[model samples]
Target: MIESHNTKGLIFNVQYYSIHDGPGIRTTVFMKGCPLKCLWCQNPESQRLQREIFFELEKCTGCGICVQACSEGAIELFEGRSRTNRKKCSGTGRCAEVCPVEARKIMGRSVTAKEVFEEVARDALFYQRSGGGVTLSGGEPLAQPRFAVSVLKLCKDAGIHTTVDTCGYASWDTVQQVLSYADLVLYDFKHIDPAEHKRYTGVSNELILDNARKIYHELAIPMLARVPIIPTYNDSADNIKATTQFISSELGKNIKVHLLPYHRLGETKYERLEKMDLAVLIEPPAEEQMLALQEIVQSFGLEAVLGG
Candidate 1:
């Protein structure tokens, strides 16, 4: 059902040598766009499907150069400073190119599967030495299903291990396409309750939970469940217990669960993207709390690992 093509995908960053996304040291291709609007998203720039301009007010020197460079008249001076009228911006990136201090930046760019493969292949030596490979991360890797499958196929064809770190919110067909090439799948679980999940992620967890079960029972892909232990969100002992129970009972497989501690690392990124409302000032779960949650999962006869 999966077919490989030369389709292009919108991506924000091609992170080289990431040890956290998957096993060993791997190159993480961060695709732009997501189905969820989690308030605590670390990469706010990846949330939008389209290319966006991030203007840093501190870096701007009140220069009108961007105004002159924008062909769509997207920029203008307001209250003695240049402000980008996003509605008028065409995303041509000319304003970013003309900026003197890099105050204006384009967040996403379109790239073909071949181009991505070539860039990631530069780390072949590292992948070979560390038992590492390529990982497709998001926004939701399956959000751009065609590009994700193509990239995964390319890596696997080259005899490299592949992993897909997804939020598990795509169609079964799309998920199957990614599974066709991925050696491992890193599935993200936010909340066990559907109402709570919709409140936090702005999407019902029905699709996500259903997809996870299908991946486990039908495809039987070697998968790891990753949970972001956020404070005041799903960090309650009751919630953790429910999660472990669901994993053990529903999936019916003894799979290891990775508990990711929520951190404030993505706070600044929201500010940079001018989406500070999405930034939540929450503290990372304490070490004691993380360990306690790990114990809960282990109590259910499963291995629980802290972090990726």
Candidate 2:
């Protein structure tokens, strides 16, 4: 069992009043680090396990405040723009703290489970009123098994409904440990074909599929499968049908399948993080396409809903 008192987790964001994650008016805690490198990933900053500096070139005025604040000499002004030497930057966030403009920002933070629990508990009234509670999301929450379990346990102990939004790629033991405290599981089923899955997400779907099957058969917890409909990726009719069929046969028809449409919301994030946006040219699935996929899921006797 994981201890909750002093366990610390690296979290990238804690989104409150989220209606799309799980149930009504929930808080989604975005943990740092992930095993898969999905091409259409929205949160690029969440991929790394440590704190990162996000520099917006347009917002930077080359004031040298960040340059002066950075004791490690990680920042330099070149042609009226502040550049960051990521390797030299210690992720101390001092440069961000001293920056006048909001150009410099830190991406992740380490917080105790107790601190997270307290913050989440603040919305207890809202959760109780709306049948919503707390959701542990990623950069696969299962990647930080102990911290995820700690936070979930604390929330569950306080009579708050807890949900784990995971990629379902972890070992069965890790999945079992975290799910023991989760009220619901928002599992991501990217692609049914293992090679295609690896081609797009940088990982095979074998372990993810196996873990999902085990979670359904071994655990009594309710699960909702989420699929991101990325263009030229896993948005094909064949992939959708195969995914829905697997969900219906292996995971049971009662499970709801959410077809999430891909968006370019994270395009700017890639620019800030200086990472390649592979899906930059890929457009979101059209409404008609989403509806068609939903129909396909319904054909397998499974409930399919567009968006979270």
Q: Pick the candidate with the highest TM-score.
A: 2
The positional error of residue 230 in candidate 1, measured at the CA in angstroms, is 1.3
Candidate 1 lDDT for residue 299: 90
The sequence of per-residue lDDT tens digits that candidate 2 reaches over residues 1-308 is: 65666899999999999999999889999999999998888988999888999888999998888888888999888999899887898899998899898898999989999999999999999999999999999898988999998898889999999999999988888889889998999999999999999998999999999999999989978999999999898899999999988999888889999999998888888889866535366788899999999999999888899988
Instruction: Work out candidate 1's RMSD over C-alphas.
Output: 1.5
List the lowest-lDDT window of 10 residues for candidate 2: 273-282
Residue 138 of model 1 has an lDDT of: 81
Q: Each prediction's TM-score against the native?
A: 0.95, 0.96
What local distance difference test score does each model get? 0.87, 0.90
Candidate 2's TM-score reads 0.96
Clashes of 1: 0
lDDT of 1 by residue, 210-303 (tens): 9989999889888898999989989998998988888899985578899999888888887676666667899899999999999999999999
User: Model 1 compared with the native: what TM-score?
Assistant: 0.95
Which stretches of candidate 2 lie above 4 Å from their native place? 276-279
